[model samples]
Target: MIVTYITNANDECNTRDSRPPKQGLSACGLIGHQLFFHQVVFCAALPDNTRMQVSSKVITGFKNVLLVDYLAARFPYFSAKKWAALVTNGRLTHNGQTATLATRVRQGDTIIYHMPDPEPPADWVVPIVYEDKWLLGVNKPAGLRVHSQGKFIAENLIYYLRYQHQPPFPDVNLVNRLDIHTSGVVVLAKDKQVLRQLSADFAAGQVTKTYLAVVHGQPAPPSGVIELPLARVPGTKTARQQVVGAGEGKTAVTHYQLLETLGADYALLQLHPQTGRTHQLRVHLAAIGHPIVGDGLYQLNDEDYLHWLRNGRSPQQMPLIQRQALHCAATQFTHPVSGHPCQLEASLADDMTQLIDKLSGN
Candidate 1:
């Protein structure tokens, strides 16, 4: 059965369906003018002949605002030009009347607009290593974005999960994020409460994360702690992080132990980061002059890194590895719903495994 709700700007909820409550659905919330049933509602298994009617009331804040401007401001995914086309095509409605570009919106007016389904990548898939009613753990592949960002909205994991997964949940949230080039176990929450708990656990340093990395040049002393502050590189739009002095940047610490040497120059290391910072591991390693193998940004000089970004990845230009050779091998945390200990592990991706084999002459 399908469930529908009408939510107003004042956060009032009104359900207009006779569907029985499912297992986990709890309440409704409104973002912009889109009416969404949150927590534990599922619209799946609805009969093919049934039609869905979902809408949200225009917020009461704007007074005498153009309908097009209001829509563009509220839903940033769509541009003003797109909104014009939608308005011209009679696809938008204001209080049950056809909405045009000149239609002025008043407080509490209902604006209804439908968004086209996102065309997610067809071949994108991740292996589900562990799953329960509250959470899902997946071995996410390298070179895959965990969520929509930059120019990769439709090619990300969340979009694929929503469109391709069978019986999709009404709400699915990512508890932790992995870099696009970092292959590892990614945990997703099926319920919002689980998300909050896991988020708090991560914030309080209650979770233990382990990563395996292959870096050029064996680190001296075998194992040690690298405590360094990290901050964004000065005046660069490339999202690069760098190690700074104790007086500046955020405090970041990583404990690393050299596992083995790959031939003469390279080494395999196990990393345990005490604090989570953007590019904490990579920046710390590079700061100590032992950048991870195939890390384009951290491994190269600033000039070379920028050049590589502009020229794209070519074997001649990037002879070592096409992507960073870091894998999130394991994570330990308390299960939010079960209230029990949980451990999740993902083996090294084929690229990292093969790179190690090649370097070790196996």
Candidate 2:
């Protein structure tokens, strides 16, 4: 079951704060000037289990946009027609009053949506790697999302850790996230103070992370640095990123060393990213003509990728590997509570191992 509650957009106790109120709503963090809609799921055993979940958001930076247009852009999982139906059914409100299809929302407007809670799959198990008084580390399996997103409200790592684990960690918060197909170690902070410190450390480039990947071809140089700028492709709804002219997009740097060669078609590489950009590792490798094995979005052309997505992301389309071959092999950082250096590691997932073995004729 899920718990429903409403939180003010201007609440001072944000996601980074160490001590949020123990009762009522949970705080969702601010993204620049906009507040992100956050959901907290409670177990069925909890006393106040509810059928519906309430999500509220504060509008900003847009000028007199149609309600349906704004909702479609913000929540792409729901179509404009669906949002219209919800408005017609009186399930949405503007500033505490019922909203309609003709509603034009602007800055400072409050929109509230009441929707049913979705049940997520609960069969997958996540292995705990390390734990202490202030931090917890877990090896997230490939295909497990780090947080709740569209169509996967409760089927995520955080939801399982907080509600489904043998001993629920209700107060824990995520310190880092991995892409759904990338298997690796994920860190969570037990308290707000530790979360804030670790966040600062990440922002300051003090934390170190290493990744392993199997790419289609061998890089020319055994070891080198990739200094490329990346920007989102224009006029695309998927937010695909590509390398841009220097000084045009955000700066991204990565250091890579070839570890082993698999026959004549694939190679294993160890990567260290100096700057954290969205899809930096995958994009960098692809820009250098060695896209990671089974990365359909980056490896295949736009038309083919779109066709694959429309076809339900079938593994037969990508017979080389089931998912991207990249994995977060290790992470090193300073402990927020003890101020001691710590290092955590995760082994490669079985699928990747099998792919390598097949490529090498083992």
Candidate 3:
């Protein structure tokens, strides 16, 4: 389980630490997850503690790549934990086994991606808390992606399923996506028919979504509402979503109540996004003032922070919490086909919880 940043086919350097990693689709204008075609460079025998220079073709499959030990069931190579290091890190563009001492080529096949990645094993058995033949539901962890996108193309929950379990869940699909930085319960359709039904319901606004977030500052009161139209301001690519004039924006709304204020500087919020917009929770909150902690994209840039203040957010405070602190805490909707109501939610993951605890202690 080596943590190496992919520069190309040859040069890969190890990171200081593998914690608090960073990516995916066009979420908030992000590179997001896109799949790539790759090739395998065969190795004769397990090198004696020698690192192999992976071909660039395979490395391009992921963004901010990390080389991991992939415990391939299909290929016998290394121990599972060793492989989990890289696999869990969102690395491993391809899975291969060590060529037998007397063998020739390894299991290097050009695997084409279906625009989706594997799902985490934990989520699979997490309890079909509520399930039917048509749909399956489980609480998704924070830092997990619903589909393939930039740095997380195939290292996420969706990809994990195909990698680990290919039987009962031969076809896994996400009707909607939760932010990679957010955590909560998500629903998946086992087949294409169920997928279409659920997708339609979402488009018709027949679905219900709930989220929780830890913010930099406390809202003045226990609860409040935000009505802001959001839009992409051209010329400012790679930045926090800017608040714009009505004519230049799309309709977005959020209802949030302070669940608990850690102090004058921090608060826990129960959020509900009325409309599904990119960075909806993060943008709205930033427009109001508080930015999610560790918001690498938005807060990472001071100019974007300034732009947020110019939007609807009060200029009274700068970003404190970073990252898109918003999480998809819960969701409810009638089964697209079954008509039976379904609901699910995920608890705070280690990263979020640890961040909260560390900051609170500070």
Off by over 4 Å in 3: 1-129, 150-153, 166-168, 237-239, 302-323, 355-362
lDDT per residue as tens, model 3, 191-309:
77889888888877788888878888887767888888887656664544677877667888889988877756888888887788888788888888886765655554666555653
- Root-mean-square deviation of Cα positions for candidate 3 versus the true structure, in angstroms: 13.6
Could you give the candidate ranking by TM-score, starting with the highest?
2, 1, 3
Local error of candidate 2 at 226, Å? 1.2
Q: 27-109 in candidate 1: lDDT tens per residue?
A: 22112222222223444322323332335566658999998898778765567888889889876778879888789988778
Candidate lDDT scores, in order, read 0.74, 0.77, 0.56
The deviation in Å at residue 265 for candidate 2 is 0.4
The TM-score between candidate 2 and the true structure equals 0.81
Residue-pair clashes per candidate: 4, 0, 34
**What is the C-alpha local distance difference test score of candidate 1?**
0.74
**Which order, best to worst by lDDT?**
2, 1, 3
Best by TM-score: 2
Error of 3 at 212 (Å): 0.6
For model 2, the stretches where C-alpha displacement exceeds 4 angstroms are 1-49, 55-70, 73-77, 85-112
State the displacement of the C-alpha of residue 83, model 1, in Å, after optimal TM-score superposition: 13
The TM-score values for the models, in the order shown, are 0.70, 0.81, 0.59
